[model samples]
Target: MPFKTEEMLLNVGPQHPSTHGVLHLEVTTDGELVTNAEPTIGYLHRCFEKYAETLTYQQIIPYTDRLDYLSSMNNNFGFVVAVEKLMGISVCERAERIRVIMAELNRIASHLMFIGSFSNDLGAMTPFLWCFRDREEILKIFEEVSGARLLYNYYRIGGLAADLTPGIEDRIHSFLNQFEAHMLELDDLFTRNAIVIARLKGVGMIPRETAIAYGLSGPMLRASGVDWDCRRDEPYSIYPSLRFEVPVGGEKLGALGDCYARYLVRRAEIDQSVSLVRQCLTDIPPGDVKEQVKRNVRPPVGEVYVRTENPRGEIGFYLRSDGSTKPSRVKVRAPSFCNMSVFNRISKDILVADMIAILGSVDIVLGEIDR
Candidate 1:
């Protein structure tokens, strides 16, 4: 006689480590295989958009820091650009270079967190330690310039909160020199491990078309072989002046658009971010970093939508001003929320263990999703 089977429901977390944040994965399973996995968000409900209306333009800067706490600098970059566009204010050359440098450094820091956390999710504890060790170097640099390590509300509507601190570039260059060698060590220890390959290769595959239809972005989109990046395609700030490669997944890395592809793509982006930071450091000009503007200057009655590339993906802000210091309307196009929409589609009929792998690969930060 054939074996009997029964279906069951499993909750991955609103508190579990595998869920990455305050996210719940409702997984329906038949024995060990997951039939479907649906994500339940909103454990951290930060009403950033609603609050934007109540607060002045400058006050909203600190709030954006909470959206994707990992990519706070990039979040600041996107919002300030939107306000600047609405006001028709162009920042100085020095400030623009500094903006790109800070944003790219944050990108590196964010990816390091992803590497560390993703490794921890997969049961490899040492790579997680190694990642955090190197990541601390970047955080030190951020703290020196912005005066805070994680949530640096350092970008401004017209320029930056402050100019780059003296000798910061030398410190960054020193970190980059060591970080490159360290990444190769990480590659040997984690990326090429036989056990990791068996666990991730050919698992949770999303075809290029499906990724596009589902509106994925950042590493999620690029890993599926999409040649799109908001920084390069939609140039903003000093990104047009920077040179870097957009990494994509394919046969060279592993199976196209699989869980492994997502991992590999993010790994490659770290190198590109390092290069971007170096370029900004090399040619940064001298000028007043801040453009003189009122502390509560009002924008002309207008609406503008601006998108910038964050470490997670494209972060766009829609700002409508009624000639007031506070915006009348503010909406965010959060990349993680868009990327999470496709999870259930690819997650069906995989092993429950594989579901965990897929979720880690998604790298969802619940703060942004719930916000």
Candidate 2:
């Protein structure tokens, strides 16, 4: 078996739909097995960071939305948090509660696509349509609040774009109630489905230590038995005041941190998000959501890095200000970019089709990766 084989080179994307958003994998294979895989990115790059230097702080918020477009609210939160930290602004209690609601809702939206696309990759088409059906509700909420369906640009430096329109809270409440049923349906349909379980349970086994060493975070890290979460560990934006559990790895995984483990971890996190949103609805106070900042914007001449747990992982921004109208430099440390790096190491010895499943489970947005 070792004597007569030749390695065949295969180019898998940059145009192929299965590669998922302009991702190109240069795969080297021996027969049906992948021997080496390298991810090629930058295709979707829009130079958002460089563009940030020229725009006012407020102008850059929409650009962040485009990064992880599926979780635009989360992106809005991250960009605004960095600017708020720079300007020494803290959001009010009501604003904090609303931010949590929006962020968690976006998390649900992003993960639904994960469940849908992951199953779809395995030849299950119905899940994709069902996922969009539920996710449409989330987009509707975003549209009502921010006046845009996808890229909301809803967060201001010190607060949000506007207070929730009347009945928005009630709508969110209704949506969450229905949302719980959707998660349960999803679990019944796929999480425990025999085919999905068999294909993903022990596949793509990334260990706890390897995950940490590779800088994995979010569900990926949690699935590897690490209990660290930026929401729980380094709390910001009222997360410190909320009550929620960080769902880590469980025994069903056989201590094998595989794709299924990550999937289950996110599934459980969605439930936790539901609980958190309900709590916010109960405890939210009545007040001005925005902090009244000086009409002109300026920050001290210094650099600071702020990181938060996005649905993908720890999304951080390194911001440098020169006490001017614009930031001197802005560097976005996207989690997908870091997590996707693990693909080359993890995909070795897997089949091409299995590689697609693993990639979808990783749940990367190429816009964020390429930005």
TM-score of each: 0.98, 0.96
Model 2 regions more than 4 Å off: 1-4, 252-254
| Model 2, residue pairs in steric clash | none
The predictions' CA RMSDs to the true structure, in order, are 1.1, 1.6
lDDT value for model 2: 0.86
- Per-residue alpha-carbon lDDT of candidate 2 for residues 1-371, written as tens digits (9 for 90 to 100): 57798999999988886777899899999999999989999999899988999988887888999998888899889888888888777878888888889899888888888877778888888788888998999899989988988888887788778898998888999999887887778778877889988888777888888899998889888888988999999888999888999988868443457888888888888888889888888857899976467545788888889998899999999999999988999999998988898988899999888888888888899999998
lDDT of 1 by residue, 157-209 (tens): 89889888888989999999999999999999999999888999988898999
What pairs collide in candidate 1? none
TM-score (C-alpha) between model 2 and the true structure: 0.96
